[model samples]
Target: MRKYFHIDLNDRSIETQTLSGEALARAGRHFIAKTLLENDVATVDPLSPDNPLIFSAGPFAGSNFSNGNRLSVGCKSPLTGGIKEANTGGTFGFALGQLELSGLTLYGASDEWVVIRITKEHEITFESAEPYMGLGNFEASRLLHEKYGDKISLALCGPVGEYLGLTSGIAFTDPEQRPVRLAARGGVGAVMGAKKVKAIVVDRHKMPPFTDRKKLMGSIKQYGKLLREQPVIENFGKLGTAMVGDYTNTIGGMPVRNFSSGQIQDPKDGPLQVGGQFIAELNAGRGGETTHACMPGCMIKCSNVYVDEQGEEICSPLEYETIGLMGTNCGLTHPDQIARVNHIANDLGVDSIEVGAMIGVLMEAGVGDFGDEGFIKDVLTEMHKGSEKGRLYAQGTERVGKHFGVKRIPVIKKQALSAYDPRVIEVTGVTMMLTAQGADHTAGNMHSIVCDDKTTEEVTELSMGAQKNSAAADSLGLCVFGRSVTEANSELIVEAINAAYGCELDPSFVLETGLETLKMEHEFNLQAGFVTEDDQLPDFFYNEALAPSHKTARHSAQAVNEVRSAHF
Candidate 1:
């Protein structure tokens, strides 16, 4: 039996419900889709008390399966005004799983500042959180650890979220209790802030039961050994995602200076200064650790620690998306300076990608100058001080672009592009255009989807297939990195799910569940007033040709609609 703790913040009431049979499909992305559709919440205002945010752990969460402990945070996004599900890696999901629980449904708004604490004994407590209000994420984490002991799983927010910044994200502490790993998209934290929650302290000490522990252990060990031998997985452990900078720049897909060009202005030195090799050197000199895991039992440790000139900790897990948008896109070549901005973004509890894009738009509007470290530092300070521009900046890239009237902003459905500019990597651009998540890279990471020969005619199928595959992985609660294993060897996933829940499921059944989840999500978006016209990239992507490659976005609105209408 799996438990669900429904915490209504309005009356400070905690209720427990049990889910079983077909209802508990591992509680990752799929479970969220089911729950959202069941509640018919798509048409409701996202920030209203009626919209519930679900925190669900995957089925293999409390087990030894590699990368098993992912937390799926789903809500009607205040950012996209549609259904949003952001999955993150960290200790929080596994901790929650120890309570024999699949998920927690958070509803109703609190009258004032509140903190929800769940203990090892399953006791839920609500307390005043105003004393800790306005504190940045790192400090708030330190104070929470001091009060709750260092091992407690914490999900917290900073001043920016409390101020309802549209880009605010929910920050979760890693195993070492550092506040960094985040469900960092779609304004999930602003929804929590609107619910009047400052932090959620969960200390679940009991693990979920496995029907056949011996068989489950054997399957996980076999899969783990197989993943260890993969070269791509190995590189992820070594270089992390920051390695994408070198390749994207070489291909002329890296957005430079707010999508004005793809090629770096100083061709000889630009890539060298801002790419992965620079980050590797910085790590070597500062004694920072690379190949760090954000979650327990993750075989692909694609994260790193970043330190300053004095070898003092600045931030951890400085990612490729942050590298591209905050580094090359802003004309910033100093790795440490970018790391500092990444750190500030984390502290402010905002999405670093959105912040970086917003800064580029401001530069385009002549409010700031690109490549000026002092100017960026000053801007960050103003955001911290809650100045008018800072508050405007917190509204995210799309709103800021609208305010500043920047034409060439690289956006899809008002959300800023992650690292990949659609001009060069055209297949991924297709995914960005058609998906309901609104320009999210993970909507279906276009990296893995390819045919024998990638052609314009093949774009729709590749993007649709990638999205379907990704949706399946999300629904299964499996890391997308693990897709090579679970997808290719579907029986392995079936075996694990059967062993976890004592249920019988075949490979096709697993595939269909994923497809169904995507359908539910698309239906929800439709109900939220999203029409066929919203499926294409912004106007500039259609008109502006990127440098070097010189290719504009080629997908016509009709082509995109054709993909959307195929009914994936």
Candidate 2:
């Protein structure tokens, strides 16, 4: 029995509800989809008061399950103009679960900014947060922590969210309590800003009792052993997601120079500056860690902490997407420089991917030379100042591209693509083209898609499978990377679930929940005026041939729609 919390901004009130019976199956993502549809907000403007921001923690949270602390942030996206669910791994999600909370639905809008605090004793407090205005995510978190003390978890935004940047995301602290992890993508933080809520702090002083302590302990140890033995997971523990940069560049999937080329093609150095091993060595020399966990009890710690020349922390856990879009795609060669931009973007509460895409488009337009550190710093300063031009940057790459008259902008539904170049790793491109959430790689992956004889048909099929699995993982609050160990064996997760509530749930129910979530979101998008035509990459992807590989992306609108229709 999980509690449902609904908070009204205008009325400054909080309410709690509970559901059981048939609705129990529809928890987390499923429940969120149902609530959005019931509100009939399919066609409502995402930034309006009527559009609610829903946050849900899945069944695995608060349990001894490994990698089960992902926080799913759900709402009609201002960026995609469709239902959006982006997640982040952190203690907040687990804390919510420990507090026995299933979901939090926020509605209405406030005239002044405020902070919402929830205590372990279930006491709620609202404070005027105007004094903390213009603060960055890190600063805001520190001040909140000072006020509320330890044993509390927080979800907050920075100046980017305060200004309603469409690319901003809600930032949260990791297990060490650093505010670096984020529910990053699809303009989620903009929705938070619209509600005029600066932060939501949850006290984690108490936790619910487990159903079976012995089974939980066994599941935790067994899953930890399984993760440690997997070679991929082991490597992840050594190098984090940035390790994929070198592999993606070799595979012709790295986005370089605004997607003009995959690799930098320098015969002298051979893309070493953007390589993963190079970065791992650089950080190691600086006493920065390449392997760290975003959530507590995560067996596979595929995260990092970057340090500057003084060996002070520059950023924590910079990912391949950040390196690909901001580094190679923008003609940057130094890992330190990329880390600086990542720090700036995160501190300012802007999505690094979105800012990176904007920088790439600007580089393509000759606004600044590629690999110019000063130019990068200047652009970041402008964004922070919110100048007339910086205001354009805040909107997103599509707006900036249209303003600059750049014809080859890589965007879908007004949202920019991630680091993956569509010309290679074809299935991921298909996933971006077809998913209701526009151009999101995390929504699906390219795994299990490539075949001996590659074809557009195979890409579509592989993307569909990955999307379904990913949807399932996100809904269950499980990390998709956990698929490595849990793919062949789901009983571990089932055991954890059974231990949580003493329920005898089937192992397959997790995936089933994810499948239903996808269907609900798909229907919501259709009702929100999305059509088969909207499911597509840019026209340039189909025609433009990428360098080195010299391959062009090819997929039919009919084929993609068929995949979406049949599966979703």
Candidate 3:
């Protein structure tokens, strides 16, 4: 059994709930949504003490259950004004599982900034965060390690988060002890900051107990074997997620210059400099890692360590979203330029997607020229300092666009859209437009869906199914990158869960968890005053056609909502 803690930061009180069997399994996004909905978190001010910040680990957490240690951090999003479940792969979840803890919720705000430490001895201490305050994640992480030693995983609120920046995301320590892995969207960091939690330091220990260790071990080996045999997984392991840019660029679905045009470079002109194939080759030649695991036991290792010409580390896991939004969207052609900014963004613990979109909008407003790396650096520096201009930039893309009176802001539900442009990537666009999580591509990323001739109903149907699947993956702490294997082998997946927890669950439980998660999240958003009209792409997407394909979003909010309403 694992213990879930209700931490009252107000009075330093703690309430523990023991979870076993399916209760331990039914965690992550599903748990967050259900708890929030039940607590009437919808009406609470996102930054208020009433808004609980939840962290959940999956059933197989701390085990060698490839990609099963991803942590879900949730709250009413200060950025989107709706429910948010921002999950990330890191050692945080693994640490929680090691300590035999399923999850914890920070209830109410602390009077001062503090570091909460959880030890293997079952001790919870609230330490002063004074020294770590006003520091970036890198420095804070170092100091935390210095104070608490290296045998701990961290969840840090960066300098931006300390000031309650909407662009901020809670940074988690990776297996390598780098606090770069982030639950990086929808202002979860801002909520953590508002709670005055500078960091959560959990001591790492050996893997926790399981009901059927032999069966679970067999399942683990089987899952790894299945992963090794999959072609898609192999490709990801080789080139990482940047390979997605190659396909998106080829199809004219890649976001370029603040969503002005889709295609970045002609395929006839050799490989696109910004595309995955090019980056993989470039990094490989520079003696940098093209494939690395962000979390322990993740054999599908799609993450990377990007390097400069001198083979110096620039950034770890330079991803497609960061490249598309921060590189192509901002009109910066070189990966080096993107990498420098990525490091700074990661250091500041902000969502590179939101910050990139915000910067792109600023460029669109003529505040700075496109491709001007110096100007981008200046803006980020200000953000780190929490200057007036920096704080304004941190409000995120939507508000920043309004502040500058820019007409073509790329946002849905006040959250910046992911790299996928709705005009060309229709199914992903539908998912982004409708998801309660607010334009998070992970909610249901069907980048391969063909919508060229499909009706709005047909498109929504496809989107709905993908959403359920994605939600299930998130709920289980399984990476969507493993879906090619996991989705096809649902019986095996259920068998593994049953083996670990000694509970009986069918394959259908996967989709059921997803469907239930969506329903709960949607209900929360609805009661939070979000109307059907809130689920839509910006006006520019509907009116302006993306180049090459010259396509515009055709899915109407009304039609999509009609189908969703019927199902939900």
> In order, what lDDT does every prediction score?
0.80, 0.80, 0.92
TM-score of each: 0.96, 0.96, 0.99
Candidate 2 residues lying further than 4 Å off, grouped into runs, are: 19-26, 265-271, 447-452
What is the C-alpha lDDT profile of model 2 across 460-494, one tens digit per residue? Answer: 87887788778877877888888777666667777
Model 3 C-alpha lDDT per residue in residues 1-568, reported as the tens digit of each score: 8899899999999998999999988899999999999899999999999999999999888899988888899999999999999989989999999999999999999999999999987689999999999998999999999988999999999999999999999999988899999999999999999999999999999989899999999999999999999999999988899999999998899888899998889888999888889999999999999999999889999999999999999999798999999899999898899999999999999999999999999999999988998989999999999999999999999999999999999999999999888887888889998899999999999897778889888888889988998899889988989988888888888999999999999889998999999999999999999998999788899899889998988988888999888779
lDDT value, residue 441 of candidate 2? 88
- Segments of candidate 3 deviating more than 4 angstroms: none
Q: Put down candidate 1 lDDT per residue, 1-568, tens digits, no spaces.
A: 6788988888988899987745666467777877888898998988889989889887777666788788899998888888889878878888887777777988989999988998877889988897689888888998888898866889986777787888888999887788888888888888898898999998847556777877888888888988987887887787778777777777788878887777663456654556666687768688888778888778888888988778888888788888888777887877787888888888887888887898888899898898876777777777767789788888888898889888767677667888888867777788777777788878777653433256555787777777888887777667887766776877887787777677787878677876787788888888889987777778888788888878877777577667656765
Which pairs of residues have clashing backbones in candidate 2?
304-317
Where does the lowest 10-residue lDDT sum fall in candidate 3?
448-457
Best of the candidates, lDDT: 3
lDDT of 1 at 234: 83
Which candidate order results from sorting by lDDT in descending order? 3, 2, 1
Per-residue error for 488 in candidate 3, Å, reads 1.2
Query: Where does candidate 2 have its weakest 10-residue lDDT segment?
Result: 19-28
